[model samples]
Target: MNRSETFMEPENFVTFELVVHGFLVLIIGTIGIIGNIFCLLVLCRPSMRNSINCLFIGLAFIDILLILSAFVMFSLPAFQVYVERKFMWNVIDVYQYTTPFVYPIAMITQTASVYMTLTIALERYLVVCLPLKSRSICTYGRAKRCVFTVIIFSTSYNVTRFLEYSFETFVIDEERGITVTFLQSTDLRENPLYISIYINWLYMVFMCLVPFSVLFLVNLRIAWGIRQARMERSRISSSQRNEESLAIMLMVIVFIFIACNTPAMISNIMETFQIQAVKLTQISNLLIVFNSSISIFIYTTFSRKFRRILLQVWHRKRPEDDVLFRWKAEGGPNLTGNRSTRTISARRGARVLTATTSLEFQREISS
Candidate 1:
């Protein structure tokens, strides 16, 4: 078999690619963009402020860029064909011009997204398994630094991707007054040394193997920590329980990342072996798009606090309502329970005072 020979895909595969990469990506990407915007709004609120949520905000922003770039690179091309078939406006030329830039951005953001998830998992692992050290290690300053580092590394790693393609323009039909511009692969992209060292070995190790192995082990440790805490549930504090909840939520996110990313990882490995896996590659792209789009749903489903803040934002409710809601959620005084009204009011007042003090303490620590 010729290692460089193109594989001929079956007709069904074409249809599958068109539907999955075209319409499905369009729908999912649209929803993902809007959902991530909402996620940003919710995460940015004062009540949601924390190191983890700060990382989440960064992740959401990266996902937005990833989805948008995928839409332009993959979805718009599909639409371009559809427009040609229907003889519609040639707006698809937009993709032709934007792809060179968007392609590298997408690659950078996807790389950043993977590492950011890993960072979140590692942070959670520290918080859950080594609570004492996490106080100093997982501060907001460190989280921001981690994010900035990931962005820098991702961009630096993908700098070659930006240089891999060059754009050119030509007249296709002089009589019809038609011209087209498209990306052409540069020699660097075709160089065997570059391909072997950077594309195959470096990419597989850094993007695939390292992250997958670390996340798997860290998540297992986190699960063990949560289980140990649960066994001593009666002795655990409310804050500990909240930590477990957050850890579980992050575990779900990591699991989804592994699942969605496994196909792409497999495709990459197969390609490294000179195997033709075009269909798998297409499917992997769709899954990656889906992965980038699903975080908001995960956050809302796993976090009551997130949902409460979302509702508060939507309803424009008072800040006191949030404090009261949190107090109640933490097993505060029950206004309608068997307790007498005076006793309930007194307990409620005390709880409110405690909550206020805790909030102030958190503010001081955060500052």
Candidate 2:
């Protein structure tokens, strides 16, 4: 395990690997770009602009960047045709020359996306579990600042990546003068200590374990808060219900992160232990990409506001019949036109509970 390790290029093209990775890159990248863009469009709306939505927009933006970068990284090699080997080799050469730069951007964007998700979970946890404190802590201004800090931290932190990896050309055969391009780590090529610490400790512990653990625990608190509020129906105002729904969506996203990212995390750890995990790493990478790509679907499915806004943007038609919730900072009762206010007094004998939206009031009245 103390010995230096490096990635060496294969002498011959592994058709299966190229095909599989290419397919994943093509499919996932296309889906991710489209979905993230749609989410961006929906969340960017003034109605959706808020502290939590700010984090989501940041996450979507980072995910899009990561996906597009990964797409180019994976798809470049898939175009290798026997007849066009010369042309493709030139393409590979260009990619290899750019690997040092591209890898850092990918790493930084991926890290930012993860932090953004964690920030989101933290925001939801506070909003659901500690509503009053969250008001001050989870302001839109604060969220924007947090996102900027995350980007700065991720970018600055991953600067070490430039020192870690480089593209090296290796001669596989001298008779035909066959050469292959490889992405090798300088630290791994010269000093094994760096990767041992970087991957095993910094990446496994700080990047993977700590974040996931915090997300899991925070989401658990959010869920518990929701359950407790539901048990005492009167404590659950329309705004609180909205918080609960948002919490559920956040929890689902965290679950997907754990599910999609666990394999890659484990693979990195396994490699650190000197277990041969190249295939596992490749598969895990696909899952990681997929995890990043598929989040928009979760947002669209779980958030009605997201869907309505999407439809509004797409069709240029407002479906007024579709129920909408307009959350207000201050709770009050107001009546205008056909809209009416409804109150559900808390069983604990609280004085009044106000609905967050006209739609919720109408529904409660009808029910």
Candidate 3:
């Protein structure tokens, strides 16, 4: 990889590339809006759903915010030119001060989302594997506290890097009217203005290693919890239903985590092993884009209800301005002629269906 590798764009780079990239961005942004908003709706519904989904819903919302915030860079005219260039590192993209904000914002948002996933995993692990004591430790209040803790810790993890970016460690050069920033491996040799290896190690550990370690252990425990649930509930408890719900959600997050971070891991490992490969770095960088892009798919897979609600919300006209909730009333009887149906709200345990709510409610209540 040469520092002077000039990347030339096609003759109609701005026109064709912008059209394609803009459409792609709009589609992703639309899905992000719908998915995150729908997750928020599901979280706000009632005690049961909220209790289980508060962390996940928050995660969904953060992922949504990450995608939305990325539009700032993606929408900028520089993005068109940056992507057109062959080398991302050589391109003059975001402003220097903006790097302090944008880079950490992206990293922290990602870290926070994964932290929430870890919390969700641990919660499921305890509930499934140690049901007796889980009740004592994993209450809704405790879960809420954990959510706050993740936000705090992960946000702090990225903030440290943001501070480092401002210390004049990086050298900015103007090449062919393009400002390029080089993130040198180190700047603390004979002449040291501010950069140090200790600081670089700090960046590596927090920005990469610790978060990776946490995600691995958390996802592993989630798998263990899933297996334990299947074994323990095989006889009569019918724990598959519960395990399926939690597993799908956690698995989606874990998969996305892997997709987003695997490239970076490979590059980092190559460096650790003293192997040289620029292709690996390029591949990993591409994965970062995929990591950000695949979030909508994750939502669709983990949450069937989220998918349904998102479709409805997207198709519905003036949904944001509307107030009244109109649901399909799942499991409602398909009535025959000569019988009109009217649904009315009622207090708990009260009859709302022709004075004849079916036995399903009874079965649930008894169970």
Candidate 4:
């Protein structure tokens, strides 16, 4: 759907794809909005307002916008196609109203989000392993600078994409029957210029393997540092345990990010090799929505704070599963029904205790 070959395949275009994407846009948009809003709340808290947390929170907001943009354009159109509702013309109108630019704003958003995530990982490694240096350097002022830099640099990527690709408008007249239009796509769609012979190598070197190597090394060093501290101390302080949990959580987050995005990246590389006709390009577009959607689960589902905020959002009104999760996270010392469990409450109480001294007393009583 995004290539520049100037070939038309209406037969290959499945209208049902529009329906699937419509659902996708709504679902992903909801996830992005809910998750990012929670992240923003957490980041705004004075205690949580640090460089690493700021980075992740900023990423969530970006994802929200990206998902929204996708919803406005791809998903809605796909859904319209499925319903045969002719609603895409309205979506195109919304697209014009909402989009900052006419060309691939989504591509830009995802690219920026990826680099921002890498920055977040780097900041996390620093904060966990080099607490002193991180304290000195990772201030609000420094974090703001990093965020600004990421925004500016990521925006520049769109320049190349727009310069390389453009769009066309088509009209279908009654006398002429049907008229078609062609649109040129982004520069990332092209083979590397100076290194065309080594397209895969260049992409792997600059975009994939190099960054992966650095992130893996940083993660390893942080893991090793945490282990050494544990061995030397023999007894872990609450602070030490906090550091370990954070490091582990952050590490898993980065690993999951890489895992979720790897298949799509490989698919992009394959595009440069075998220009196989786009079988399910719309499906791929929907996958992009899925890609952005899963970040919510990756960041929020595993953490106590995320659950707390989410529960707070639904305060005193929830279904069975949410009630279960809330019970599990809150140390419901006196859960009323099937939600009750000593082990579950103990674990949640420990979390609450770690977070608050008042809760610490509560946990002891519950125990």
Candidate 5:
């Protein structure tokens, strides 16, 4: 095919792939990478560390990997048309050399991210809908284990992706000394049984069907649980209210996941039926990138604790400030002790009261 007929053909000097998956992804992915990094930093803090946040930390880290891989696989190639021939040649050389590994890494991270999000949903369901059992079931150690297990499963499931492509180097024009390398598919990648079972059926089942179904159901239960909790707002403790808020935040995340992932799932179904959906697939890829990029915003908007901790990290505030902020925001200290401890508690409360009154006075003056 001529350049004009090629899929990467430019429209007004910019290709569709370049515009959608390349330049757009470059901008969004950069923001996502930075946002996920901030998420990691905020989630790691003492105040934010918990079972749910641990899973969030894993999700954020996987997102960073996925975004970086997307940049290399999709975004970098978009810039080839804008660079000098020599630079483009080097870019192609680097891309070719790294594609085999990058492709598998991207797949692995993407799958891990999907499962990680699922894990978060399941964890939230247990906590919010099955609160009585969640006390025993959900713990920091268990969350870490779940994260590790998902990583292992995602990696093991995608192991064949590593063998799917083999790198080949050859001279395109010996006279002009132009040499290039490209990834060539292996026999295993072409096998009908492998393609049908692993690539088509299993991918649809595990990556799309199962996660989406479970997320939908779990989110419904979570939403219902939050509704029930709101009815008894007067009886619920501040901590319980915080947990409910976290659950609400997670529901929003799952909602976004479903919305962004629906196109990709539909595209997969079309491809499974031997239908050509190139445009749909491109749109799906864009949405997937977008989905991976927006979790930080959801957390910021829906979880007050996340916002507070994020601000604390950004401002380099003391840990005590976090406690005081929580106490102030929640309307009291979430303290637990026996009657024998009232003396010491009252002394600490007096100090806290004095400090809080002084801070409130300063705030009133500033306003």
Candidate 6:
């Protein structure tokens, strides 16, 4: 199908799609931008700086870029088409030409995001499975280097996509005198066999399958490590426990990534096989965007320290509230439970003082 037809298809350009993709997508993209910014703000704090937080900060930055790209490339254009009867072909042309360049950027960000996740997983694995070495390997400096390396390699790998697409003018309707310029694949999309093999097999396997498998297995290993440590009564320090929690938080994000991207991959495979799954493809794209948008929420849900600190920084709570928050955090009295070590310590101290005073008085009388 041609770009015009694909964009303005009766099924594709229905009111529902206009409302969803045009309006709702912009909202989601905006929220994602803000959410990721908040993540950066929270994760970049001196107290929050760690190897995993470094990876998370990188992921958040990439997600922000991805959301911005989606807004410019997809959501804004769709909104323009929905609102303007006389759509500017020039704008669309620029969009078309911009896509090949943007395509590589998006892939670079996405691939880097995936690799960062893998890096986090590996860091977690080392921390849990090989605690002694983890301290040496999972330093913030090392994490920064890994993130830099991932970005460099991913960008290098996908830069070829920019050259693989170029714009060509195609006549949409001779009677109506409509000619539109749209992006066309140079050789890969033109050749059926090449497109099928590259997209269906190679791209799917490397991009989706390998990453998904690695994430799943690594998370399973983390879970097993946690269980084994508990069973063996191994002394996991507070920092190690925090690392495990962070891994669990990232595991949820990775699961969302798999869930969101799998449908898109499936649709790509079906399209390669000449199967009709346009709706599935559209829905999958939305889900992928959503996946990119919701990581901050997942972090908030899993990390109490994140939530507390975020609330403190964002809302600027009162000093009393801060004291209360710290008390609760330190296992003092809380709303859900009332057993407080502070109260126990206070009572124990008083009893000890009374017993010492009585013993001293009795010793003085006997002497």
Q: Comparing 2 and 6 by TM-score, which wins?
A: 2
217-320, model 2: which lDDT tens digit per residue? 99788888888888878655656666777888889889998888888788878877878765566667677678778877887777666766688878865533
- Candidate 6 local lDDT, 302-347, one digit each (tens): 7876776577669865424654444444444333434586577556
Candidate 4, after superposition: displacement of residue 239 in Å?
2.0
Minimum summed lDDT over a 10-residue window in model 3 is located at: 358-367
| TM-score for each of the candidates | 0.83, 0.76, 0.62, 0.67, 0.81, 0.75
Q: Which lDDT tens digits does candidate 4 get at residues 257-285?
A: 66656655565566657655444445555
Give the total clashing residue pairs for model 1: 0
The worst-scoring run of ten residues by lDDT in candidate 6 lies at 358-367
Off by over 4 Å in 1: 1-13, 85-95, 169-181, 318-321, 324-354, 357-367
Q: Each model's number of backbone clashes?
A: 0, 0, 0, 5, 0, 0
Decoy 1 TM-score against native: 0.83
Native-to-model Cα distance after best TM-score fit, residue 121 in candidate 1, in Å: 0.4
lDDT by residue (tens digit), candidate 5, 24-128:
888888899989998998788665556877888999989999888888776665566445332444434445566778989888998998999999999989988
Task: Tell how far residue 205 is off in model 4, in angstroms.
Answer: 5.0
Which is better, 2 or 4, measured by lDDT?
Answer: 2
Best by lDDT: 1
What is the alpha-carbon lDDT of model 4 when measured against the actual structure?
0.59
**Candidate 3 ranges with C-alpha deviation above 4 Å:** 1-30, 47-49, 72-97, 165-200, 232-240, 269-286, 292-296, 302-349, 352-367
Candidate 1's residue-wise lDDT over 212-304, tens digit each?
A: 999999999999999888887768765776788889888999999999999989988998887887667877888888999998789788777
lDDT of 5 at 117: 92
- Top of the candidates by TM-score: 1
**Model 5 vs truth, CA RMSD:** 7.4
